[model samples]
Target: MLYAVVDIETTGGHASANGITEVAINIHNENQVVESYTTLINPRQFIPAYITALTGIDNDMVAEAPYFEDVALQIYQLLNEKVFVAHNVNFDYSFLKHHLAAAGYDLNCRKLCTVRLSRKLIPGKASYSLGKLCSALNISIQNRHRAGGDADATSILFNMLLETDHEGVIAEMLKKSSKEQVLPPHLDRASILRLPNQPGVYYFKDNKGKIVYVGKAKNLKKRVISHFTGNKPNKQRQDFLRTIYNVDYVVCGTELMALILEANEIKRLWPENNRAMKRYEHKYDLYVFEDQNGYLRLAIDKHKTNNKSLQSFNSLLEGYNFLNQLIEKYQLCAKLCYLQKTATKCTAHDNGQCFGVCSGIETVAVYNKRLNNALAELQRLQPSFALVDDGREAEELSCLVVENGTFYGMGYFKDKTYLADGLAPIKNDLSIYQSNSYILNLILNHAAEFPQKLYKL
Candidate 1:
């Protein structure tokens, strides 16, 4: 296999916005370097001080050098039909892909990451940075940050991996990549490559632009790639893959937000392939009702969108189990909770577990008071509240708004003063979603840990 061991110094982190200042490619044919190329390219933009300090490539050095557009064709021809190998292949591949696209060349090459290879072949290292790894392995690097020097060092390291690859892990990785290479033909590589590695919700749309599936991911890029690569591709998964023409994602502030948004979007879109999430949409609801004899009773029932529920469960069995706990904790009547069917009295009352609300032995007024207390215990401590959490970035804060025991929506704010007034001024910022038992449970589950501050609205 011809491996193009590549490296590049960029103007910035973003592939679309940034330009490559210097790049190098060392073509290896398993045994030795067969061909090599390196150049300083004028990025057409001023390199930041921090970047120049690291890469040692200043504007003056690249001022008269060929622009990326000028060298795009040559680079494309050299790298095409070769495994695009690099330390962190994505960084180099994304940069090259973006620039090549702009230069009217569609460059699609198979990739092999040396960092990943080293992690598998040479385990238990303190650091994995190219310089650190090379130093630890005693692979000398002359020009630490220069693209050509780094590329040559990486090529040497890649050769070491080739020698040390005893378990055929590299071969397995290539096979996996080969499968992914064809699974979703219409899904563009650029879109998948650009997916941010963060918590988010993603939508898979068909050729007609209809969402066929909705999913949540803690790491958007990793999760989405696993979808296309990791699974064994069962009939259902294969069918799902066939229908997917594109994917779009929304980055969330936290995992909790991503989960909530996923549930909401699944309910809203009712995506055909999202059976798992759809099943949880309205599974079971805990409801409080007044019986014919004017006693407040609690029951677990199949969820309906119109039903006002205290909380939700993914299954009827789960709802029953939770209700059983509440009944025992509060000495609530089994008959009242639909756990007993006897008309005269409940087994709980007979066993002294219940307060005899099922029979005349306990006064109705006293029994009803205890029932109300139990219900109150189940209600949120703060009826209308906002959960303030870390937003997508450091300067912003995420707000999960709940108004009068119902979740309104979620939004982010930079100003602390806006939070003081309670979700009114930032209402425009919030993307409203319908309140559901699942999301209510999401809030309760997250609030259990007390990870975020709660403010009464």
Candidate 2:
């Protein structure tokens, strides 16, 4: 029940080199185009020899023809409330949009393409260009490539392709091609439909005005739509899309730029679905909890705000258990470290295994000295350092670092607008963990030409 099977003759090849010369629409319903129209307009310039030879409409033929504005109304009436079916919908639709934009009339319509549908429905066609498609599909064109004739062919081919089955292919391609993926109802299609597939950060927000999820991708729109298609998904991604009333995006020039932008925005908005920031891993684990009895109890608590601990573990039990095994191996004290504080003779001493203070078996001074030796086994996460990385450029990535905070990381800046002089200015970021890790590792690897220089912030 669609209206227009449309085609247009353009001035030339590249859209930037052209203007629409002839317009035609064949209106059809129930698989029949009941009405048809066509017009040639003065393109306000000389028609090239190739175009003249192709369409058989020359410069002299349209030298005195009506201008586009003269016939815009008729074109609108014919195309209004109609599905715009064309060979390559993008070319035709883009040309049409440009024409309408210049003439102060907005042309927005649902678009369907014969090419995509033909690929899906009819299998063996070597080509889908209007000329070849007609020959391949056994449909004949009277004037070949002329505006009205091409449209008539597309209309016939649209019906014939549908005859081959794959019942919903037309509708599905029509829905996807007519607009960008999953747009908010109020926002117009062309707004994001024209977004270049460059690297960028994208944001999704809810009706009550809170950011639900933030992400970055080398292909912005493609990545954003993955949440909707449920291809490879998570529950958080699903829930966010369900509640997303709007989408907002920024186009970064490169992947490195996208990386920084994503980190910055996630920290700023603190989206509910972002899980990387809140999770923190342990740095140091093996430590002594000095009890009030002047006895050292080897526990697995990470060193506090003061001194660094030996290592990190998932739980205190694992730490003490590991230390206990080491204790038995070293034949050390159960009582001197207060492990059996009430024993008259230490558990280890009773078994002739104690090197402990129980029963005056060992001195605290020597025990404390050996305890420092076990502390050497742990690796400590650095407190304050600038983790330099690649910045976004032809031979670059970027740098991110934390100064005096747990959550802060830095951004990139340039001394000059040209950015050809030296290194950019440093901007620290806060509350970004995944990006910090990504910067600390992934982005830095991209800058392999130079070694990373760790500096105290």
Tens digits of lDDT, candidate 1, 1-457: 8989999998887565678999999999988899999999999999999998998999999999999999999999999999888886766776888788889998778777777678768979887789999999999998989999999999999999999998887777677443334335446555687889888999889979999988999999888877765323134654576577789999999888998999888888889988887776667889988878888888999888887888778888899999999899989888878988996899887679987777877776888899788777767453677788888887988888887677888988886678766557767789898877678778866776784577766
As a TM-score, model 1 comes out at 0.52
> Where is model 1 more than 4 Å wrong at Cα?
1-183, 230-233, 281-283, 314-333, 346-370, 373-385, 402-407, 422-429, 435-438, 448-457
lDDT at residue 120 of model 2 (Cα atoms): 58
Q: Rate the local accuracy (lDDT) of all candidates.
A: 0.82, 0.62
Worst 10 residues of 1 by lDDT: 177-186
Q: Which structure among the candidates has the greatest TM-score?
A: 1
TM-score, one value per model = 0.52, 0.45
The C-alpha stretches of model 2 lying farther than 4 A from their native spots are: 14-17, 176-457
